[model samples]
Target: MKYDFDYLIVGSGFGGSVSALRLAEKGYSVGVMEMGCRWETDTLPKTSWNIRRWMWKPWVGLRGFFNIRLFRHVMVLHGNAVGGGSITYANTLLVPKDSVWRDGSWSGLEDWESVMPGHFNTAKRMLGVTENRIMGPADILLKEAAEECGRGDSFYRTQVGVFFGDEGEVQGKRYPDPYFDGQGPERNSCIGCGGCMVGCRYNAKNSLDKNYLYLAERRGAQVFEETRVINIKPLNGGEGEQGYEVTTQSSRLFGGLLRKRRWRVRGVVVSASSLGTQELLFKLRDKGSLPNISDQLGRRVRTNAESLIGVRLPGDPEMDKGIAIGSGFYLDEHTHIEATRYPRGSDAIGFLLTALARGQPGYRRIFTWLRTLLKLLLTKPLLAAPLLLPFNMARQTLIFLCMQTLEGHIDLRYQRRWYWPFSKTLQSFGPKIPTFIPQANEFAFNMARRIGGLAGSVITEVLFDIPVTAHCMGGAAMGKTAEDGVIDSRGRVFGYQNLYVCDGAMLGANLGVNPSLTITALSEHTMSHIPPKQAA
Candidate 1:
């Protein structure tokens, strides 16, 4: 029987993009349904001159998509573009520690730590991962501190997916693909605009749009943007068989101007982000759109236990003018910190660094940062006046990004309470996440202290403050038991056939660094279970 392509993809992030490319490569007709637009990187906004215009969001509208807000711990940054989060994230890619892989419930499924190397190698090759070739003052200073504390060996530059130009050429110069062997489009060098966190205007960032998704679209994947899937159901029946009915709402046209649209497909893969995929699955399960979904719907959610803290260079004031996450410090076996940056002259959206004290619910890290600001204000006129100068703040501020492989997770469940009776109180929030304690990550704070850089408090509760996560994982984890898993070891839905989850959501534990590699690797592994897409 004919279907809408060979498979349907729910999101356009790393996992979805990889599956799209691989499936399309084998001549399968694929449809990738993304909730955002195809943001053109060639002319994307950069610099403080146009940051508000650079960020992206979907809930509040296109304008709100880009002009995102950052709290002390959690910085709500997501891309409302066809390429998803890759469109806006800094390319500081680092694989998680082996320790993280060992703790997950599915750790025994396969030799995750050993067998994943080949997949990771392929991901690196595909992503153009390389040691950061450019060094700025912030990185150099951080290295100095790390070396002084005897952790210099651990402070090498990150393997970022940036394209630095030919010798002596400025970073923005457009040149042929440095690693593509003339196979792909010309690549522009990184101008180091620090806008990567917003969106890379330089075309230097290896965002999936330029690589995997680009090639996938070229091969045969049909990509739809600004199309949010409102509901999903097994058309043949909710049982393990046949086509699917995908109901969607277009964000492009006005509400009344358009009507709900539906499509049919044989197989479906959920790759929307942790929050997105979780909500989509929850809706399908709760509203009975797809009632066969597992009872463990929102289990194993992770935040990477991350935080961001900023440090100002002693004398240099413009240190925030580099790549968004240029350098970092690894304090110990568990705690990792990076020096994240924003373009110069942008709004002072301060830094984050973690393992901090967790506060009472409803009164979180954001409130704490507010309190800190209030304390500073209250003290400025009395004692700390001299330190309140703009120069001191800029120079002394060290944007610290704290991360750990320590494991903790949240499960997504319905609040079931109505907001306005008509409003969707079906909100997705953490279930009173466990408190973040600093003592567990003290080796890292001590490393910073040894270098004279003070511990950047959470500005809020640890889970809420210093929050830095590019790869949010596991709401639908893979396991052998429904009591423990959502997707099986083969990525198939626990009780159903032809449904799979091949993204970060499948990971059962927190990865300490950028999780794109692991997601790509997992996607590749899952694709092996899916035979080459049948031709139309």
Candidate 2:
């Protein structure tokens, strides 16, 4: 049967953009449904302080790229834009250890060690991956801290997806397309602005919109921005042999006059982030629109076992002058720590941080935090005032994003909350992810002490015993059968024809590093299984 498009991909992220580009290159007509605005360098926010254009709280009329979703167990930092999290994420891309293939539900499902390298190389080339070239104060601080802790050998520049034009050349210099032999957009060298997370106003960041999605559109893939997929039902008696009917509406909260639209697609790729894909699939299963979806839909969701710790130097340090996350080091075999930053004047995130408190979880941690605050107020009222405020946070503080390969997971359920009886939303359950990492906290404390500053942590960790993670991954993971996981090794959703998951939700293991590169490579792998349009 003829359909509106050969493939309809949800979310314009690392996964979705890769799928869109590869599928379009294979001669398939692709429709990319992105539930966010398309951002241009000129339109990007100057600082995260501009919440109206930097934060993504549609309920409150903020329609920016950065988003924070609070769950019972964790605070998830994600993004919403045409390029998804790449619009807000620090462009640190690193390959996970090979042992990841032997862990999690996807273990032994495929010869991942042998197969993933090629895809990684392809993703790297497309992403314009390179060793960070613009190290600034934060990188030096991280190296000093690593050396102070006697792990200096582990300190190294991160591999990132930023375009640095040339050695000794002026920064922000515009040039012809460098990665795709002029087939891609014109580029500019990074100017060491540390504004990647706020949105790269310099146009040096290799966001998907500048690469995969850009090339995909050039190849005739239609990207429908601000289009949110509300429902998807398989055609041909629910077997999806013919195609699927996808219903969508404007993503804007006040877009009531924008009537819902429907489209027919021969195949659907659910490339939304972990939370998004799981919530959508859960709603579909519960509503019986896609009842055949595996019961394991929301099981085994991982947060990359992450923790946020930092130091606030309070003055005279230009810490936020490099690329966001320019350097990192391993504290131990399992723990990886990266120096993270927002641009100068983007201090909004500091509202979530407070003086670091080291104690047990629950009431003990809260008590310790209270004591810390009390002591600071009593002894150093002047210093404590600015330290506690969000002002100068981006310029004066150094954030350590610590992640571990140690496995921990929470199950997401679509159910009504006690407070909100009107609707069932995605909620997290299971053993709580660790809110405190002793090594990371200790390192932060030592660094602060050495710099004559204050150590800090996410306030939620001390107040509510919940950690924050930007790298939320794994929900509809790969497994051997429908009973075991929601998708197969190749990302084909179990019990569904011509349906696939090609995002963080499909990641089965804790990567212990930024998952963008892995998600892109895995999406590439998933796309490889599909024959070209001629073969089909």
What is residue 79's positional error in candidate 2, in angstroms? 0.3
Q: Model 2 over residues 30-70: C-alpha lDDT tens digits? A: 99999889999999989878999988877678989998999
Against the hidden true structure, what lDDT does model 2 obtain?
Answer: 0.91
**Candidate closest to the true structure, highest lDDT:** 2
Instruction: Report the C-alpha displacement of residue 106, candidate 2, in angstroms.
Output: 0.6
> At residue 97, what lDDT does model 2 achieve?
96
How does each model score on TM-score? 0.85, 0.98
Give candidate 1's whole-model lDDT: 0.67
For model 2, the run of ten residues with the poorest summed lDDT: 250-259
Off by over 4 Å in 1: 47-52, 55-59, 64-76, 167-170, 238-240, 256-259, 312-316, 348-397, 418-471, 534-536
- Residue ranges of candidate 2 with Cα displaced over 4 Å: none
* Each prediction's whole-model lDDT (CA): 0.67, 0.91
Instruction: Show pairs that collide, candidate 2.
Output: none
- How does residue 141 of candidate 2 score in lDDT? 84
